[model samples]
Target: MPLQRDASPRMASMLLTTYRALGAAANPLLRVFHRRRVKSGKEDVSRREERFGRASVARPQGRLAWIHAASVGEANAVLPLVRATIERGFKVVMTTGTLTSAQVVAQIELEGLIHQFVPYDTLPNINRFLDHWQPELAITVESEIWPVMITELERRKVPLIVINGRMSEGSFRNWQRVGGLARSVFGALKMVVAQSDADAERFKRLGVASAVNAGNIKFDGKAPSFDPEAVQELQQRIGQRPVWVAASTHPGEETQVLETHRLLTRAFPTLLTIIVPRHPKRGQLIAEEIAGFGLSVAQRSKGEEITPDTDVYLADTLGELGLFYKLASIVFVGGSLVPIGGHNLLEPAQLHCAIISGGNTTNFAAVYRQFNREGGALKASNPVELAAAVERLLNSPEETEQLAVKAAELVAAGAGALNQTLEALEPFLRQETSRQRTKGEV
Candidate 1:
């Protein structure tokens, strides 16, 4: 059903014009930031035919569904769903906005799954995309509501759903200002499975009454497997030393973490800080930054071994967070300390590592708030607090172990969301299957 008859043309035009201006500003900035993706062979520029209704295309022998996530974090949350979809005999096309996410999905090695760079959300591009892929159903992960894309999907009569949907308070305020136009976009989605009741209520305000409180799918992901031999080697190399990790550190946050590392090393002389920057390109820059701090730094990419006297070990490589998280007794999730809305704390939690985060976790506020309430995680307001949390966790091994166990249990309790989300998707999946059969694609 279209929204209540309050979608005035003047209002819609005003909203869209604002969106256009924002897009105009954002495009150049994003292009600059993602230049590495464009320069490297990682990104594909060729426009592929849509999933169906193209004369020269090869249609799938079975059913097909499309899942789109904005980046690595969102991509990780959708893995369980992707695996379940394939197990249920649906050909899944997973699309991500970043080169890093594309690489991660490729590594998943799911048989019936294909990974692609999501087409830009413009009329001709989206039309070309939809006309070719002709996905039976579309699922978007986490707050990606592209107007043209949603409108095109609606026009083609494809059922569109959003999984793990979230609207931060800031975003909600912006959308509220747009009024009816925003409501129309929200109404376009068939269903919204949100991470929390707070998020669901926000969607409700945007006119999406069908929003359901689905627990975060990030909590549902299985812990990454670590190489036993590698673990044995690393453990032997750093025996009896207290180790902590600062995982997925961002630009400004890395320096803060390094300062904290500097402060802690004075007391626990044998302490080791493993720093993993969110971007691989920033690894060298981080090495230089730490070098300026007058600490001996070893780079993982250079195959430099962390000596007993080494103060900092830079795990600069990509996709090895599992390894580092596995080694650490305590983890400080970065990006949060500096207002970047935090990265997934659940990853370290799954590995039974005591977790600490900064105060600015708006991106996953509900999840972190729940963890904080359960005593499964700690929050640090600034560099001083962050350093103290690390020092405190390191000095008290028993408390660290207890906190880690609680964090693990909390994550385990949240594991069934993927199954629930899959169950809720059944009706829509059935409809898509029926449509595909009638169109002779099955």
Candidate 2:
């Protein structure tokens, strides 16, 4: 698809202005404080730059298939694809936007994979990045469509594809308002592989002609391999207590979860609630909040042992979701309770934890919608409903087991998307190999 020549300049200007305004409005107070600290010499920019340079250069590259994921969620979604790409004998270059995601990727010990911060979306920076390690093909794990980067890639004639492509209803409406400008931007891509039919249709409306519904890549993610000895140790430590995990919970949602925990404790005396905040910084805050509930809480950070009387367990660490999911009976996928687009419910589903979510799951709407239809998940709209659902499941062993089985089955059925995605990429890979061969002869 070629860029739309008829895109209105006025509409483009309007769209840019709107984005700037939104950015200004949504800028975090923490970012402002961080900037002030850097300006005041409390933080060393030079050291930061040096560290980034070292990390970037450490990345090994050769006939690499590069994938860019904007954050931790998107980064995790690419794991299956990364493994498949590596198995097919292509070195994988995975780029992410956040330090946490980078750290997580670093810990993975992927033999043929490298992690790097994606260059800023400017032509010079992108070109510098491309020059360091030329990729055979570039795939972006969700909707990270930066015009300057895409245009540069197009100029270099690099093959680019958008995998697990999703446009939120809110994003779709905003793109509709910009008309052909959005269309032209999406048109630059070689293909758009959507997570759902709705996403495909939305891309079509935006003039993305080469779009296909390939399902979500997250659905193809395998449960993180757990050490049997470690699982047995944790299980023995956890005893016969009924444990519910609130995974990837956000700020306001944590308080709601704590309150729900208090309500449920009255019914099931041995019920243990595990709260894993989406941001680890909130661990201390969540601990304080749980204490304010007048309940004795155990902190994973403090290495405290959980007792029968312990009301809440605060998991304040990173990259131990495999352990948490293994211990949980019913897991509430957070970020859904509040409006912070839902976290990955598939993680818990793959681990065979009975899945529960709230209504505000716009980010993974298609995935959750399918899970709900498949009888693999339960939806709760409020704290009371969440508590009731938890209580019902905790009291009924048969129902809980049935839900977990169904959820795991749903995940198993969805695992072939990775193979499908790879099949779609074979042509581009062959084309790139042919180009390299011709260049070698010359």
Off by over 4 Å in 2: 1-55, 58-62, 86-90, 433-442
Lowest lDDT sum, 10 consecutive residues, model 2, at 46-55
Model 1, residue 218: what's the lDDT? 88
Off by over 4 Å in 1: 1-10, 17-62, 433-442
Looking at model 1, residue 120 earns an lDDT score of: 61
TM-score, every prediction: 0.89, 0.85
lDDT of 2: 0.77
lDDT of candidate 1 at residue 32, scale 0 to 100: 57
Clashes of 2: 0
Candidate 2 lands at a TM-score of: 0.85
Residue range 1-442, candidate 2, lDDT tens digits:
3334445867665654565455445435434654675664333344243222223464464577778998887887788778877877788888887666877788897889887777555444566677776777789987898776676666666778999889887888777766767865776788888887888888887877688888877877767566678678767877888789999898899889988887887887777888887767567778998888898899988898787778788888787777888887789999998988788888888788898999998888877888899889999988899999998898888998899999888888787776777777777754555436656899
In each prediction, how many residue pairs overlap at the backbone (N, C-alpha, C within less than 3 A)?
A: 5, 0
